[model samples]
Target: MANAGQKNRLVAVHLDESIGRGPPDIEHERAVAIFDLIDENSFAPVGKEEGPYKLNLAIAERRLIFDIRKEDDTEVMTHILSLSPFRKIVKDYFVICESYYDAIKSGSPRRIEAIDMGRRGVHDEGSRLLQERLQGKIEVDFDTARRLFTLVCVLHWRG
Candidate 1:
């Protein structure tokens, strides 16, 4: 393992605030890129045979369990940068985040974002904001050293 101060990586996936949005309308190609980045360690997909191989991002050898279980037909991804290695290795990584309410199942704009603090500390406000912003949206917070970013995934369906 690297030293305590080694820099890590953060790969976020979600809506782009730049895109004029109800939620991030992530394209299929971009989606692939987001997933590819998280899989940088090449851990291999789990839960594939029985269901969509899934799990929150793994870090420091353990998995960061999702605040909520991911629903089918839902996806959230965004890119984050300048995060610390410790937090990058543990907090922000993800395999899946269930978005039932606004899930893509029905086809609506949903947003997913990951922030790299590149440091360490616990966050709760953003999580609460997500809960308030989108009914039951999922949020992931990472604490590396001081650098950190919040991953927000919002699911809303539209016809």
Candidate 2:
């Protein structure tokens, strides 16, 4: 059952196609993250009450853009955040993910597990940073933040 707070969740999410798709694994991750995020999340732009919003995330002019709208496509607000704070974390995440993928190919179970743990740790760090950055603008739970961070990483994908 959903509480009243859950009413503020996101009903739709879209990534700008112009951003260019990543490799197969990256695409899969992006799809899964979008599915999980829409399935369950708590998202409310600060000082706003009505919701079940729609979000279109994009990276333009080196800025991370959050295009928030009402369910009916009415524009609510757009937030453009600097990407500088996330550069290091995003780079670190990609490095760890590469190691994790390689480990899954032939490495021992123990090695794979260790790499996965490190990946999750880096993911959590990114999630926390996202929450901090959106502190005064948007309110999101940790899980939502994590999922959003995943989408943010997808937007940063160059391959």
Top of the candidates by lDDT: 2
- Per-residue CA lDDT of model 1 for 1-159, tens digit only, reads 222232223233233333232334323323543554343311111222222222343222222223211234334231122123224322332212223223435534433222222112123433333233322222222222111123222111111
- Compute each candidate's TM-score over C-alphas: 0.18, 0.96
Candidate 2: global Cα-lDDT?
0.93
* Number of the top-ranking candidate, with TM-score as the measure: 2
Q: Write down the worst ten-residue block by lDDT for model 1.
A: 150-159
Candidate 1 global TM-score: 0.18
lDDT of 2 by residue, 97-144 (tens): 999999999999999999999999999999999999999999999999
**Against the unseen true structure, what C-alpha lDDT does each candidate score?**
0.27, 0.93
What's the residue-level lDDT of 122 in candidate 1?
26
TM-score of 2: 0.96
